[model samples]
Structure formats: C-alpha cells, structure tokens
Target: MPASPHPDPFTGWLRDHAAPLTHLDPEAPLDDLEPLRDLIGDARVVAIGEHSHFIDEFIRLRRRLLRFLVERCGLTVLAFEYGFSEGFPLDAWAQGQGTDDDLEGHLGETVPVGVDDPLRWIRRHNAAATRPVRFAGIDIPAAGGSLLPALTPVADYLRDIDPETLPAIEQAMRIAASFAGTSAASAAPAWARLPAADQDALTAALTRLLIRFRAVEPLYVSRGDRRDYDLALRRLEGACQADYGFRAMAGLFAGNGLTADTSARDVYMAESVLWHLERSGPGSRIVLAAHNAHIQKAPIRPARTQVPGPDRIRLQSTFLHTPGLDAFDGILHTPAATVARDLEEGKTP
Candidate 1:
C-alpha cells in the first residue's frame, strides 16, 4: 500500500497537543476527574466556564466537576453568577443551615438555568459532609428585577446599629424603592424619567451611607456580628452598582456612549469572589461557576462590535484581569466532545 501523503492538519495538531477527557460515570463522577488536580496545580481559584446555561449536560458536568474540586482538591467555596443580596439563603442551604425548600423559595425569580439538580445535590452533600463547602453569589442584587431587596437590608442594618443615621438611610431606601415599580427591561427609562434632583439625592444618599458605615467601622464591627457587617457592605456595594447599572441602561437607550454598567457589574462580581477568598483566608480554594463569557482571561469583544447594541458591552474582561488569579476556560473542543458523547449514550457527563 502507498503511504498516506499526510495526516489531516487539524486532527494531527489535536493528537499532539490536546488532552483527552475522561468519561465520567454519573454513579462515580469524581473517579474520572482525578487527573484535573495536576492540571489545576496550586491555583486558588478554578473558574469553570459553560457555553450556555440551559444545557442539562453542561449543568451535570459542572456539578461533577464541583464535587471533584471540593472533595479531591479541597476547594472551600463554590461561587455562582447569582445575586449577592440573595446569596445568604442559598449559602445557608449549602452549609446545612437551611432546608432545600428554603433555598428554592429564596432563589425566587433569579434562579440560574438548569440549577434544580445541582441544588439538590449540594444540599445533600452539605448535609452529609463533615466540613460543608460554602456558597457565594457574585452578582449585583438585581435578581428580583429591582435593587430593593439589597437596599432594604442596608437600611435595616443602619437603623439597628446607628439610629441617628436612620434619616439618611431612609432617604436612600426611598430612592431604591422608586425602582420597585420598574421592571428590569424598563429600569433605564424609569431612571431617566427621574428628576435631576432626585437622581442626585439618591446618589448622594448612597454615597453618604457608605461613608457613614466606613466612618463608624469600629462601632459597627464591635456592636454587630461579622456577618451583619459583611451583609451591610454587600448591600451598599449592590446599591451603588444598581445606580450605575441604571445610568448605563439610560446611556444604552439614548445612544450616548458605552456605559460602565456592564463593566461595573462584572467588577462587583469579581470583587465579591475576592471578598469570599479573603474571608476564607489563606489555603482556601474557590470553584467559580459562571458563563464562559464571564470567566475567560482573554480580552473579549462585544458580540456585535460594529453595531450599537447591548451585545457590544465587554463585561467580564476587567474581572478576568485580576492579579494572581488563574482561570481555565472549560468550554473547549475536547471536553465539549466528551459531553456530547455522554449525552448521546444517555449518561450524565
């Protein structure tokens, strides 16, 4: 037989460089993921990316990967692309402090796509594990289509810690309450319709609330528990981002310019992740679960750069650039192929 002229270029390249994925059994998922420890090395944060949220196979694969990271690699935190304000209940459920029903109820309108199975698994895992893994949500508190849920908590915290600041806190709460009637789709228009004075007052009130909290840090910390202090801070951060997001939306509608709203949300999510890392202290590893677009370390262009559309916003590029953080874009050819094969075989990957 005559020798073949050459191997196909793409197949030859893949054969030389690509690492093949191990088929994962649903009954024994982590058995196949042991090799990933070497691949992950000593990186503190392993960000697993997904191409889409609605895929059952992707969700199952992520759940298995999360189990591997937690059990084998000693990862202590599993952060999600969920609202920070709404994370407490979910965290409680994961830590075995709340019931599954409680978590589902608290998740309310902002549940992530294909989260049902994973949620049940996490609850069971936490209940059985000696040292339960913690959960952290890294998005702004817009899960309920409004920032009220986040802002209300801050106001209540202030009222408890420093009654003297209640007036200022209430002012901020009122501004946030104005958003209750607005849907996520109409937030920008509603914000744009507000009087300039109201807008300025809302901004000033939130700013002052943050400043006041900072100024009384010692008192707040001493009087309240650490969790309370942390919640207050998270609420403040969410409120500030809410304001920025509204402005960004307005800009998007008016064709003013590329607003920082999307960027700000990603930055806040990154900050939330870092905060969890800090709280967990040294020797802590985090398994961050977000969309591929939000986790990739490379510069990401807006989907439609040439056109004036919402897709043009480069959201998570800033977050990916955080120093000392290592990221892996898991939506690659090899693992995706593995997932496809598993789905075809009627097995969860």
Candidate 2:
C-alpha cells in the first residue's frame, strides 16, 4: 500500500523481492508459497534464516517453509544448526524410531529452538513414504557444547577398527574432560585455562587420529561399512574443529585478540551440508534451517551487542560463498522483524 514503507533502501529491496508469508500454519494449503517456487529455482539448498532465534513468528515461518520445501520442492533433507554428532538420535526420531517423549528429551537438550516441530513432522511424513525424509545437523556437536559428542564417536570407531589408536582418542578425551563435561558453550573458557601442553596434546591426539584414519581407509572400510567409516571420519573432523574454534575463542578471551579465527565452525557446517549433498546424490535438494547470520552472504553488523573478545568477528555463511557453489539460493523472511519492545526503547531486556 505505502511505497517503501521503511526509509531504508534495503527494506524496499526486501519488500520488492520477498513474498509475504500468508499463514504460519504448516498444515495450511501452500498456495500462498507458490511464488517461492520461481524465486528458489533450481537451488540445491534453500536456507531459511532468522535474524534472531526463539522468536515465535520467525520460528513458525520456518516450520511452514520447511513443510512447503519438503512436500512441494522435493527437498528430502532438512539440515539444521544443531549438533552434528548428537543429531543421530534426533535424525532417528525423524525416521519414526522414537516416541514423542524421547524426542522431547533430545530436542530440549540438543537443539536450542525451532527444530522440534520440523523433526516431528518429518517423523509423521516418513511414516508411510518409501524414500522417507531426512535430517542433518551441520553444527559442531551440541551446538558448541562439547567435543565429546564427536570425539567419543571417533573413539568408538577407533576402538572397533583400530584399537591401537584408542590411546590418542582417550588422551584427547582426557583433556576435553576439563571443560567438555557437558554440552555447553561454557567450555571455551575452561579449555583456555588448560595447560598449553595439554592443549597442544589434544591437537596432537586428534592429528594422529586423522592420519590413522586416512592411512587405512580401505582396511577400516573392510572392517566396517564404508558409510560408517566416512561418517566417523567426518565426525572426528567435527571434534577437531570444535577444538580449533574453542581454542581460538579461548585465546581471544585469554589474550584479548581482535579477530575471530578461520571461522572453523562455519566451514565445517558448509562441508557438512556438502556431505549431505553427496550422500543424497546429484540433483537432490536440501533445506537448511539456520540463523540469518549463518545463511546470509552479506555480513551482519554487530549492533549494540555486548559480545566480548573482538571489535569484529569473522562472519558465518561466507564459507558457503564458494565460487560456483551456491549454498542457499533462496531466503524467505516473515513479517515480524523487531526484537523486543524494550530493545526498540533502547533498554536491555
């Protein structure tokens, strides 16, 4: 009705490109979402990004968009910003393996928000379907919670196929225990406090595991399924990444560094999404549900944020900006955009 209602030029562009979501209900007919079909033309991953998490409107919009993508666009995999290693059970839940009660417990502790409904719906949708829908967690184990989620799995794999390597994994686990007692982001500081030798030892242990895994891929594959070996390798990679990222942030905390590291978590996430693509085979589509900062190619300015340790940080979603590789071809936004009434009033909530 009103031309470019917001004074910002970007809002005008957004209004021009975005088709306002009609209803928040996933069960509702998706005729209103038809406009997105062209906007999302031939994209492999349709990343639905929210400016903030735990917002009711954005969360509902994600649900509706996910349903539409899976049902209409033939996107079989719904990758999330949750823990990669801890996501196995959640993925199983999507495949109808667990009851709602079981899923409730997992999602409560595992994913922060917005993933439960999609997983529940996937479970129902896969009930009678032959191919069935899929779920993938692209984040480090437990969403930056702990290294154990990934490390423990790697250790288990080594225990089964290459027992000689157990000591290395065990060593890494021993150092991880100082901070990774639980799946919480609080471990970075504790990890920072670990002796420099212990920290370097953890890296060394993981390096040994990686070299061992690569050295005997065929042997390990023969002992275990190829898929299992590959997944284990990738999961170990996640643990290594967690160590790298946490250590960098810890250094920033301990040293007051100005910039973020190589953006290890986001790089892992981009690779994880690609791994899903390879597994799904060519021409398959995936729907990635994550924060706007992680999905948007343009950087998000940290405005009025109390986040410490850096004047600026390396952005997410940029790794997905690989040349000729389009991570998210389309993005759909909802109506609600503001944070809170208090935030608008310049008062911290």
Candidate 3:
C-alpha cells in the first residue's frame, strides 16, 4: 500500500522540520513554506500577500486553517482587505441574502480592476463555509483631488483635492496635466517597453503634479453622503501598490479634514483583525490577505507592539526589490547573483 499525501509532509522526513525553512542571513529569504506553515499553525490572525509561490502555499494553509477553526476555534469570519474593504457585501451572499449575480454587478463599480484576482477566490471559498463571514469595512471616504480622465470617476477624485471638501471638478485640470506629462510612458507596453528616458519623464511629471497639489492645500467638504466614499475607502484598504497608495493618501486627507468617517480608516488594518475575532467565537481564527507594505512595522515604535493581542493581527508579507521600492519590512531579499544568472541564461521571464 502506498502512503497517503497528508497536510504535513514532514512526518516521514527528518526529525526537525525547522532546518529547511530558517535562513541565517539577517535579511530573511523565502526558500520554502516552513516559516509560513509554522506561523499558520498557532496564529489566530494571519496576513499574507500575493507572492509567486505563495498563492499555492496559501491555498494549502487555508485549508488547514479552515479545518482547525471549524473543529476547534469556532471561526465565523474570513476578513479580507478585498471584499469588506471594497464593500462587496460578501456576507450577504454567504447567508443567501443575495446571489453571486447580485454581487457581480457591484464588483466593477466597487473594485479598481474587475474582481477576477485572488480576492475573488477567497470570497468564493468563504461563501462555501458552514458559517457566513460577517461584513466589516474601513468606513472612510475616497481621497480628494482630480484624477486624469483615463482613470475611473473614483480615481479622478483622489488625485488633486485638499483636506476639507470633495473637490472633484477642480482636480480634472491637474489630472490632465499629470497625464499629459506621462502620455508617452502610458503608450509603452510592459513586455517590450519604450526607452527609460520616456518613463523617467512621465515619473518626474507625476511627482511634480502631485507635489503641486500638496502645496496648494485644498479643502474637500463632503456632501453629507458617505456611501461612495465608504465603498471606495473600504475597497481601497485591502489593495496593494496603487490601491494602498490611493487609500493612504485618502486617509491623510481625511485626517486633515477631521472627518469622523475618515478616522475609521486610519486604524483599518487593526480594525479588520478585531472585527474578525469578534464575529467568531471566544477563540476564532482568521487569515488576512494584504501586501507587504500594509503588514510592515509602522514607523512609530509603539505601533509595532500592536501585532499580537486578542485584537492584534499578525502578517506574513513578501516583496521583490525594484528601483522605486525600498523601506519595506518582511523583505525576502533576492541576491544579485541569482538575478544575474537568470538574465544571462535567458530564463528571465
């Protein structure tokens, strides 16, 4: 008889499962899934992102985590920076209050890209769960400013406004300028892009445009309607790169405006953890999906202490180094040697 392929593959291997996973180098390298596996075993709140090999690892780990929660912890929530943050009304779908068809209509209006990414997979999984996942969001508004026309209506609002009022119209001109400056870069294809000079020109123009908006200090007053703002902020909260960028900018503007709804988004990451645990029983488990930046230690020292508590959340963040990206925690350093070899051997994809 052959052996069964079980969750933990280490049973028949060497005595210690830790040897393969740990890296001695000060900068942790992700060689395999051991560290992440260990983290999932004990953690009540686990956050991770969309790393290359990580997606498969997460699917496996989620299965384990879900089983553990249903059998032992009584979990009732799978908090996502994706659905709840974007106001997908996943809980409504889970409880038979609505159908995927109902939620599908709102997905385009809510999420930045169409919701065909990993987040949709998570939502579908949660929908099949025995207990419905509760809904919670950052409850903040979109940031002020005018974005370029190429962007959606929501983005136009975030690019050019000040702290007080929702300055939608005035921002249009600024967004136009920003886009005009980067028109060439926009035309370049990712596989075989244009010259670096064109890209640099666009980048510089964008920086200048955003900087000009900051200098002006415009006030964005809300019209007593938070529906769009809340929907936008919640969806923005779970995003990486552009989504996080927009969300943080919005949060800063809201803070400056002293808006009550805006204040809710400042602690959005923490609130997500607490909200999940609360929905579950006395000892519920949760798994969060977010980017490396959202999980990184806050610049303020005291804020780092908020990682492990009943209300605290834990994160497993990963990222690749690029020209414009630095100052991120939980980095998995890719040595120059490997990258050079990949490029030299024509294995660079």
Candidate 4:
C-alpha cells in the first residue's frame, strides 16, 4: 500500500525544480524571455487559452499580447475554438469583408473576429505571414449525439485503474467527452460502456464538484443529461488521444446550470508544444491564444505511468483563479458582444 512511486518523468523534474522557475510565470512583464530567455528562443512557441467574465478584458488583453507578438515575436497564425459549416475566404475574412458577421451566431453576429480585431491586427503586423489561416471546421464533420457511447474504451480503462490515477484519467476523459460530442459519430461505443444506473450517480457527484470551479468564468453546461456527462469525459480523452493536454476547472458545471461538481476546462498544451516545435525556428515565429487554464502548471503524472499506452501527454496544470489575458506573446479573449449573442440565442450561456 505504499504510495505509488512517482510514475511521471515531468513530475519528477517539476518536483525537483520546485523552486519557482523565475521565468515560468506567464504574467511577468518582460518583453523578452529575459529569465528563461534561451529556453524559448525564436524557434520555441507559446500557446495560451482563456475563459473570462468580461469581454473588454478578453479583447484588450488578447490584443495587447498579440500586438507584442507582431512587434517582438514573429507570430504566424491565430486560431479559433469555433468554425463555420461552410468554409469562407480567409483573405476576405482577414480583410474584414462581408463575411465579418457570424452567420451561425455560435460566437456572435459580428463574427468572433473582425478586421479591426486581433485577426486583422496580426495580419497588419505580419502581412507576409499570410498562410491563409485554415478554417478547419468545414473539414470536421458536424457533431451528433450518437457518439456519446463511443467513449467506453477510455472509461472502462479508467474504471479498472487504481484511485491515485483515476481522478486524473477521469478528468482527462471528461475533457475529451466535451469535444467528442462536437466531433464525428464514431465515438459512440465508448459512451455506451458507462453503467446506465451510475450515470446519474456520476453526474450528481460531479455537480457537487463543479460548485467550487466556475469563478473564473467561460466554462459552463447547458443541460444535465447523463449522455452529455458521458460525452464530456470522452472529449477530454479524445483531445488527450490527439495529444492535447487536458485540465478541468472546478464549478464550471453549476454556473452553466449543470452539475457543479463535474464541470471542467478541457485543454491541450503538449499539442501546442509539439506544434511549436514543428513551426518555430530562428526566423519563423508563432503565437497562440487560448485559456489560461490550459497553460497553468500542475503536478500531473504521466497518463502511462499508471495506465497502458505510450506515455499519454501529462502535465499537472495549476488552476488559475484568473485567465492569462495579458501573459502571451500576444493575446485575444473571445469578444463579449459575440458571446452575449450566443447566450441570448440559447446557443451557449
């Protein structure tokens, strides 16, 4: 019954290097990586995601950080969480053309971005970096509820594991479930495995858990169906399977009208690391904007340390009480006007 030997490589390093690395704090005001300057030279990349209550805070923080990227870091692309059903012209979109309005209203009527927005801001800064930031939603299939059960493979795997690893794994699965519900229908089998009787039990348990997490805002739940719970777990796992790091913010569920105990923020930082490794170089540069929770440091052990499969990307992310709006080489929060419209239309609250 001795505590499990530290099963994670990064965890060991983090514990050993516990003295706050003078450079890790994202909010530091250095225009350059003066402390860990050599670690993230021109080739390295920095990705940040945010969940904020104020739209102005989101917009101002995001824009300032992004402006820094253009002036200091050779930032290349600006990606978004939502996409369009029909792919539109990136040039026109970037130029603030007719498509500037959000046709779907998922983000808002003014489109989550605008010509004067960060998208255009980055373009104005590095017009030559015009890679025509790809609109990937069109390529991704429309989401359906049928895929909820497809998450069982992961849940069953967690169910058979020990307690120490179970929470991290379960949390990861929840993050994956959230996204799986939005992706293709191939994820159904995994969801089918959760005991129908325990579904409510699990949801109720998670609802209590969420009560403590929603303070930072941006995380929410629309409904309390066991199926959505199943899907949320699967989405976390799916994102992890795809190499994205997952992190959950507590209490996000209750604020959005779902079980507070079970709400979380799904994240993928390792993917950003890998993506940065691939895209950054001496001359080329990239900047990413995402939730503050995604980049916060944690004491997480590797997924493979206790479970099977190659070491699933693991990181114990520190829960940030506030979003990292100004910490990036460049940053942009989702605009409030757009978020308001989505809430009004009942698309998302």
The number of the candidate with the highest lDDT is: 2
Tens digits of per-residue lDDT for model 4 on 40-137? 36643455445542244455555655555544555554543322121234434554444435333322322232223555454344445544332212
Which candidate achieves the best TM-score against the true structure? 2
Cα lDDT tens digits for candidate 3, 136-205: 3322221111122222333544543332323432343343334232111231122013345533443444
What's the TM-score of every candidate structure? 0.77, 0.81, 0.38, 0.36
Candidate 2 residue lDDT tens string, 103-211: 8787654434567778888888899876788898888876666788888878888888999888888989988877773443467767777888999999999888888
Q: Name the lDDT value of residue 280 in candidate 4.
A: 35
Please write out the lDDT profile of model 1 over residues 157-261, one tens digit for every residue. Answer: 877787887887788778767755323555556777889898889888888888878788888999888879987887788878878777777777778848344
Between prediction 1 and prediction 3, the one with superior TM-score is 1
How should the candidates be ordered by TM-score, best one leading?
2, 1, 3, 4
**Candidate 4: TM-score?**
0.36
Q: After TM-score superposition, what is the CA distance of residue 331 in candidate 3 from its true location, in Å?
A: 14
Write down the TM-score for model 3.
0.38
lDDT-based ranking, best first? 2, 1, 3, 4
Pick the winner on TM-score between candidates 2 and 4.
Answer: 2
Candidate 1, which segments miss by more than 4 Å at Cα?
Answer: 1-11, 20-28, 181-190, 193-197, 225-227, 258-261, 301-330, 333-349
Collision count for each candidate, in order: 0, 1, 19, 64
